[model samples]
Target: EPEVTQTPSHQVTQMGQEVILRCVPISNHLYFYWYRQILGQKVEFLVSFYNNEISEKSEIFDDQFSVERPDGSNFTLKIRSTKLEDSAMYFCASSLTPGGEGEQYFGPGTRLTVT
Candidate 1:
């Protein structure tokens, strides 16, 4: 089946450095999002992107964070400065629409380990 794919399944970064994680959405899906999952914790929504702009973002998406779909298919999340607290598995997801009966599809996720 068609599915979203993320690159470099795992990343180890030093604190205070920038990191960019990449994802490719499922073909034909529209709304895209970024979510974070801390070890043994719930998946938390970080930001939602649609129509080339950010539709919604959580408090965790502060000044140091940003997302972009530079190309029609690939989506990327960038952290200006990595922090220890930012270590987590980051997932990329997409749905046919912003909201409705359509289900969301998620990528395998990029495990970011900041130290």
Candidate 2:
């Protein structure tokens, strides 16, 4: 099976700033998603994209968060502004199907540190 890959394994930024986290999902997968896990907390869904458009998003994914498939092989998550509370590990995921049961394959993750 193919897997997701993410770059910059770790990212550190100042509060109120912006950051872009990158990922490359399995080439044949049709669905992509972004999820975050604050230190010591459960993983939380941020958004999902399909067919070059957003399929669903969580409340935590406010106007500040945006996702796009810039090209055939790259998917990205942009946080318009950073907040201290946003410090967490951001995981990029992909699925052969919708997020059903345990079907999503995740990347190693990029740890975001907002100061």
Candidate 3:
């Protein structure tokens, strides 16, 4: 079966540098999203993208963050400038639709550590 794949399971970056987290979502899915979890916090939605535009986004998706589908199979999240508080597990997810009960499949997650 196909699954979401993430790269660089762990990354340590300086507080002012840029970082790009990569993910390959399940093939044939139409919706994609990014979520983050602080060490002991709940998963928080960042942004949802579909049809090449943002469908919905949370307050957490500020100007420092951007996402792109660089190709047919690769989805990437770029943080222009990192901050210490940006440390967290970033998860990539995909679903068939954005509905009340849409089930999203998640990647293993990329643990980002900023210092």
Which candidate achieves the best lDDT against the true structure? 2
**Model 3, stretches more than 4 Å misplaced?**
none
Q: Candidate 2 on 81-107: residue-level lDDT in tens?
A: 999999999999998889785589899
Ranking under lDDT, best-scoring first? 2, 3, 1
Indicate the TM-score of model 1: 0.96
Q: What TM-scores do the predictions have?
A: 0.96, 0.96, 0.97
Per-residue lDDT over 1-115 for candidate 1, one digit per residue giving the tens place of the 0 to 100 score: 9999998799999999999999999879889999999999999999999889999999999999999999878999999999999999999999997754688899999999999
Residue-wise lDDT of candidate 3 within 1-115, one digit each (tens)?
A: 8899999899999999999999999999999999999999999999998988888889999999999998999999999999999999999999887744689999999999999
Pairs of colliding residues, candidate 1: none
Q: Model 2, residue 92: displacement in angstroms? A: 0.5
* Evaluation by lDDT, superior candidate among 1 and 3: 3
